[model samples]
Target chain A: MDTLNKIINWFTDGSSNKLSYHYFSRKFTPMAFIGPALLVMAILLVFPLLFSFKLSFQQWHMIEQASPFWIGLDNYFELLANKQFWNSFGLQLLFVVVAVSFELLIGLLVAVLLNREFPGNKIIRALLLLPIFILPVVSGLTFRFMYNPQYGAINYFLKLIGFNSIAWLSHPETAFAAIIIQDIWRMWPFMFMILFAGLSSLPEEPYEAAIIDGASRWRTFLHITLPLLKPTIMTAIILRTVDALKAFSEIFVMTSGGPGNATTLLSVHIYKSAFKFWELGYSAASSYMLVFIAMIFTVLLVRNMFSE
Target chain B: MHKFKSWSRWKKGLFFLTVFIILFVELFPIFMVVTTSFKPKLQIWTSKSPFELFRPTFKNYLQVFKDRNFAKYIKNSLIIASITTFIALFLGSLAAYGFARFKFRGNFLLSMGVLASRMIPPITLSVPIFILISEWKLLDTYFSMILAHISFSLPYVIWLLLPFFKGIPASYEEAAMLDGCSRQRVFFSIFLPLVAPGLVVAAIFTFMLSWNDFLYALVLTSSRAKTAPLAVSEFIGQFAPEWGMMTAAGTVFLIPVFIFALGLQKYIIHGLAFGGDK
Candidate 1:
């Protein structure tokens, strides 16, 4: 009975001094708590990553294969030499930079304007979030329809301003710009909300002191508000950067990586290579390239933003 | 503060003008969708201004409802989303408690692992996951998509819920432990009730993630478990695309998310801010 009590006590309270039981519960309790999550992740994430690593080195015609054969460095070399793959990679970088910068810029400007209390502020804030909440696929299609050259609203508006009715999605440069516009519209509010939260939480004493010193609004904003808002801005930039890099559905729907691969971002490129071309090995290699690039970006952002 | 009060009439007009312009840019496309969905067939193709007011009808919406595939897609979406949310919240809360309460070796590594899992782009996982699911012969089933979604959402749930669990006082659990309750019992009885709001936040966020996902659903489920997004995308691909029908389907899809975003604006904001944390 005493021994049993000691066992139960050890298990329950970590009170017993027995090396084995102490070690067991010490390790097992936390495992008991976190093990299911780890297991789920292993099956769903880690295994897939390792499996893809192996597949990326192998040659397999997805439909014609009873077995995949290992091909050493062939896929990687092919992807390196492939102009289409490199173009897609460069385009993804460009897309991420342009879209995220515009979103941050517009979001900051709007957030600064809307930071102060005004009538119907709550209503305006709520309405601003609709684009963020709408389905990406829906947003893509809606924009696709609206960009129609002959009957679209955008062209109609452009004609009202005396500009020619441009084929927004038919030209490569305009098609890419059109996709960026849609992305900015959908994602800018995310930046706005974060900045607004930061703005509201800023210390009032600094602004009051600036006012007493007779600082101009621009000077006060430049010195005080901008410095204080750095962390939130960095956070917004990092989050938007990550999201823009993985953007797929909108580009998939709006242009399908057209007109002529102008907007073929990495995600869309990977999807097409894997599913459409059935080049499993090549697709896996390209995806890892994306994963590598994204990880580097995230790590850099985190280190920079959180180091202080 | 003084600037706001001492603003001239022109300044006030500019402020309101900026606000109105922003509002217009935000809502005009949405309003177009709503109006176009209600337009009859002939008016949809007209060269007249897309914004010009016309007689609205329910024909497109009725057609969407009458289609059998639309109903199946909604059912599949609901089933996949609910199951994913349930499983993610359940497992995620438990893991969150572990991270929150226990300061053990490798704790930092494990928590970091949870966050790092999110960094792996979903596209990177799609090929291997698709192959594995097909091999298991589980493709196009609720189980496959639900598992995929749970995998996608669990890391987020664990991260979001961890802070909430940490916010609960440890003394309550310690007192419960003194009274001879098991840890599981204490968690369920004492700590869970205190973190009810956290659970609600996590649930809604998880639901939204699963509901909004298109890539996983596109690859994993073809017809049997087709989601609304996939259905709508496919709808756009048909020859002689009906703009009215597409808009109607889009509007129907937008309703639930719109209500959730507006009604739970605070929680959404709180959750997003939480997500932005390191």
Candidate 2:
């Protein structure tokens, strides 16, 4: 019995035959607890990621080859000089900046407005989450229908207001803008909820001090609320930026990266290259580039989140 | 003093009016989708205002229901989402407990790795996952989706639940241990009950992530395992979309999620604030 227990302990805790029951349990328990999650992570995430990295260096078409052959630096070089690749990268950057900015600005404003007590406040707050919870496909389709120049509600509204009906998703610039608008509509509620939580939990002392100082509302907002709310706002910005950079399904549905690759964000670009065009190696490389760019922002986000 | 009171009352009125407008704008698309789903096809084309009332009909919804593929997609979505949620919660809470309770070797690094996985772009993995799933001949199967979803949701599950576990007092587990229970037994009998609300929050998030998934389901599944999101996207075909049917499908997608959001608003807020899944 003692030897059997020792073996179990040795396997679990790296301790030898001289193991105490308490020590074995204390040191090895976490392994038993975390083992399944680690297994799942390794199998599903780590393996595919490593495989993708391997494929990024290989040359093969999924349809035309039995196995990929090593072709060092070819995919990377091709992407570097590819105008379409560069265009998509630039568009992704623009998308992230515009979408995250609008979401943060509007979200904070709504949070400030809805911060005070009012009738139906809870109901309105709850209703706001509907947009956040709607499936991206639904939002994309609904917006696509609404943006339809012929019989769409948006164009109809423009006509009612005596303005010319603009093709929201037809032109390159407008297509890009339409995606941003759809993203903001889908995501701003997320920002609003986070900021509202931040606003409500704020310590009262600063506000009282600002009030006693007879500061104007704008001054108090600038000095007191803004400073106090920076962490929450930063969190929202980091999350929104990371997500906006990867915006795919909605853009996939809404414009299909079209009116001539105008709305082709990085993810959509990779999708088309991989599935539609069968440029698997090139697609993998593009995805890695995206991962690299996103991780830079993600590192900042993680550091900011833990800074407190 | 009377003038000042009147002025404040006017300000309150203005505030409420602004709040009402914000609420309307927020709900505008949803309301249009729901209303349009109920409006007949003729009424939909004729209605000048998006907000106009029409004689409601279930024809669009009936058409959606009549499609056999739509029902299969809904069933697939429910099965995948629920299974994924169950698996994620089971595995994630265990890892979270490990982090919360033990000072193991490489704990910080491992926790950071999990969080980092949360940040890794799923699109980056989609290509390889597609190839690998096909290699294993698991494409268009439930297991493939369940595994794929577990990859994404586990990180979020562990991250969201870790704080909840840390918030739990250790004394309860210790007390159970003193009563001759094993550590695992203590976790299940004593600690699990205490963190039930946290578990629910984690489950809701996992379900939402799995349910709202499109990119993965779009790439991974083809015929046998298509999800509702994929089905809804299918409504926009090669040519013009069927708007009435699309709105009807969109409404079906909206109802359950909206109900869940309303019912679990407080928990959802807490989860989101903790940096849960988008």
Candidate 3:
């Protein structure tokens, strides 16, 4: 028994084994499979993100034609003082509030109904999913034409119902509203998919028991379905909020953050700072701030998810 | 009893009403685009007729092809999206398998780290990534967008497939191993075949994500790497986005996505609705 224990200990000890060819191969296999992907994600994604985070502390403009001067926290201070930054920040918040709220309400409705085996459900669902596949830029381009005041589909439809065109993307307040509305058109389908899954996966026993107890359908839905689907609701909100916060391409195409920064979210601000005006340091700082905000929401969401 | 019956009837009526309105709102915009695409150039700007097809012509579709070699854009979108879907699903699956099967240090952190990378806003990374591409001097190249799309979509593959892989029976692979098949061989023969439905879903989704991406294409590529959306965005400038041309382009743009969505609708719908096939 002692000798047997000694043999086991000998194999277990790494210093004794010197990693035999068999051991080498066993340990080596993982790196061979996972190494390349990790490297790519690290270099292209992780490294650039870290580099940007570091650069956020520096003061640099592309116009300077020199290395970025390290200016700690001043860029953040500059952003705090900039009223335009605050306004755009307000607009982004408003955009998320409006977009997420509408998508959730409409999406839940759609998912509840679509969950039942109805006529043409598959085709309707497919059509619904179509917008998800349409590139955001293309959605913007298509809707941009649709929002055309004189000759677009949206105006034509409104005119058909006897209302005049509504400067959907041109007017400042309406510009932000227009982007939110269009975003809802694209986003609800995704929310629908998530909620549909949640609803479908809901055990029917509680629902059946409620029905047997003479509880009304609405009561059952409110008490049973809604409570059961809460996790799904939370997931959708978190994911959609993350996306709505980062909304760029559509806003870039639709408003260009225009009519005096009406729709400029953090993203467009970051873009203009970095590329358009070439304020690399300030943009990097702004980018870090955005990441910080996104990470906070994400952590809250993930914790909420796992806890439940 | 009568009051309860009335309320039930009213609730059913409200349900149908909700579905109807949602369907109309969700689908009508796409319907409008489709109908407008067929309108005559003379009436595209002038006609307010939503239902009338009086001047229906293939003129817009013809213009899409003849005017700009839009066929090339279409071809490019197909090639780029297909390549991305294939490579991402393949490589991502291998990596997921490694992470799932191997007892390595930091595997959970590494796998979850994949999710973290995804959670980072693409907009946050775009400028630097574009700079990296430009420095690599790969600007206006399909390679850049392809690489960029792979980063985001690959994680999705890993995330989606990990759940599927975890649920699947590993005993079959173990059995095959006892039959003298290598781990890689058993993986191909047993694991890959078993999870095909899930893979179909992943392929369709990865394809859509890559196809739908715009910013990388916008910033990374000038002309050479212009995907379909980039091709469409090009028409719009300081002025109005050339309505007839925009209509023509948008219609052409919707077809491939529509076809793919229709084709993979089942796999994707199932995967998305329940997380994965398993």
Which ranges in model 2 have alpha carbons more than 4 Å from their true place? Answer: A1-19, B1-7, B276-278
TM-score versus the correct structure, for each prediction: 0.94, 0.94, 0.89
Candidate 2's displacement at residue B50, Å, is 1.6
Each candidate: what lDDT? 0.85, 0.85, 0.75
Q: Residues B71-188, candidate 3, lDDT per residue (tens digit)?
A: 8876777788999898888778777787877787888778767766656778788867876787688887778888888877877788778767777878888787567555455566
Residue B203, candidate 2: alpha-carbon lDDT:
90
Candidate 1 iRMSD, 1 decimal: 3.0
Cα TM-score of candidate 3: 0.89
Top DockQ prediction, candidate number? 1
Candidate 3 accuracy as lDDT: 0.75
**A204 Cα displacement, candidate 3 (Å):** 1.7
- When 2 and 3 are scored with lDDT, the better candidate is 2
Per-residue CA lDDT of model 2 for A33-63, tens digit only, reads: 7877898899999999999898899987988
What is candidate 3's lDDT per residue for A1-308, written digit by digit as tens? 35533432343332223345247436665665667577777777887888777777887676765677888988889988988778877877888888999999988987776677655668877878877766788677677777878767777778878898787887888887788888999998988888877787788788778878999878888998898888778878877887788688877887788878888888888888888888787888787777877787767665764676
- DockQ, each predicted model: 0.57, 0.55, 0.37
